[model samples]
Target: MSHPTAPPPYEDHNPLYPGPPRPGGYGQPSVLPGGYPAYPTYPQPGYGHPAGYPQPVPPVHPMPMNYGHDYSEEERAGSDSFGEWDNRKVRHTFIQKVYCIISVQLLITVAIIAIFTFVEPVSEYVRNNVAVYYVSYAVFLATYLILACCQGPRRRFPWNIILLTVFTLALGFMTGTISSMYETKAVIIAMIITAVVAIAVTIFCFQTKVDFTSCTGLFCVLGIVLMVTGIVTSIVLLFRYIYWLHMVYAALGAICFTLFLAYDTQVVLGNRKHTISPEDYITGALQIYTDIVYIFTFVLQLVGNRD
Candidate 1:
């Protein structure tokens, strides 16, 4: 030991061999046993971070424990029942509104028909001045087109009411004029038959499972057939009135309009393939009214003893 410790026992240092442990443990540089160059050491990392490094923290905020309460069975049932009731109420209201409008229109038409039928002076004047009938017919057609085809005018507030009133008046005048040519007894009978048929058809449509609203193609075909038949009948009548042919045409018209009444009623009811919206109450009333009036006209033509 006093002789330079025998020069540390003369070891051969190799570059690939591991060095001796140092006094500073794993993180310090250490020399080999043969005095080789010191190699650097680093601390090993833990599971999620470096052994000596600080861990990052995430920001926190309060969260609602229960966002919404679970509805009980009774509460859910109550909600469903309420929804059904509300829907039924709305539908009932719409139907009532449509019927009220129809009632007023019919009343106006009935008054006009009475005036033209009973008032001899007015009837004579209407017959003498055919121009008045033509004018009223023109007005009826114009207003009918606007209401039927133009949604904007039909749905607009005051304008819709105004146009509908004018349309009804013109139609009433035209109807009254035609009625004036028929005997009062025939008109009254026709009115009775029309009212009975309308009531029966409406009741049937409301209760029946048959969906007449899906018969659009059938309706169109019927209309075309009716129109063609009427044109042929008119030509025949011009040559010479055949009583049977006229009767047949009138019967066909009445039947077709009766079907139309059923279809329109189903549409208004909305439990069908096709339906009119609740907002289109005016349109619905118009359809039903037209069907009834046309039914009356055809019935009158079929049964009336012309004056």
Candidate 2:
């Protein structure tokens, strides 16, 4: 028997829902009224995707990492502190060396002065031999020029020490001869005054914020003025030795050299606009020694009673 004829393919023939039939079948895609393709087909793995469909996202790549070594906080701090400590140590050592040399030089000079001032024979010999004083002065000038102008000789190992020794001896002899001309009591008083003034000036230079190094030009001008005054005074003295005029010259000299001592001390300290290099310990010692000695000489002249 003919099985009940298969129900005709179901169709919604309702009048209210009218449209063109699906091209493929009930379960397949169909074109729209605008003649465009039905829902876009998925692209193959290697092919371009149809527009408007969510595109297959490109495979994501992670960012590259930094592999360089980084310093830890402790290591960085240690390195910084080490550098500062090393610098301070070097500066301290330089200062110590300079001061030690100066101390030795001063001791030698003081001993010479004492022998010349207190000892009868030495004092007479130094005084009678005026040529020796001139010779010592010449030696002092030559050695000073070599040390100040020739870096090679100044920095040479044993040679620098030798030159400095010779220079110190020459200067000491000259200073002692000058001391011989002064009364013992006056020399002692002048020595005390020089010591006091030198110590005071050094303390002030280290403590004060005022930078004397910045006044290099002023120092030069003052130096020139002092030199001119000294020349005029020398000429006046040759014509007639006026006690007041000589005293005035000595006073001016003492003041000028006192300022120089302060300047040189600050330079050696290396905390100012003008600082001696750490490598130039010899130069630093030389400058400071000269300033101090000059201070003593000028003070002696200012206050000492001539024998």
The model with the greatest lDDT is: 1
- Per-residue lDDT tens digits for candidate 1, residues 85-125, read 34878889989999999999999999999999999999999
Report the lDDT tens digits of candidate 2 across residue range 1-307. 3432222244643333354543222322333444444443333232234332353354333433545756678867765434333477787898899999999999999999999999999998887889989999999999999999999999989989999999999999999999999999988888899889988998998799988889999888879988999999999999999999988888888888888888888887765677777778999899888888888888888888887
- TM-score attained by model 2: 0.72
The per-model lDDT (C-alpha) reads 0.84, 0.80
Each prediction's TM-score versus the true structure: 0.73, 0.72
Each prediction's Cα RMSD? 15.7, 16.9
Q: Where does the lowest 10-residue lDDT sum fall in candidate 1?
A: 1-10
Task: List pairs with backbone clashes in candidate 2.
Answer: none
| TM-score of model 1 vs. true structure | 0.73
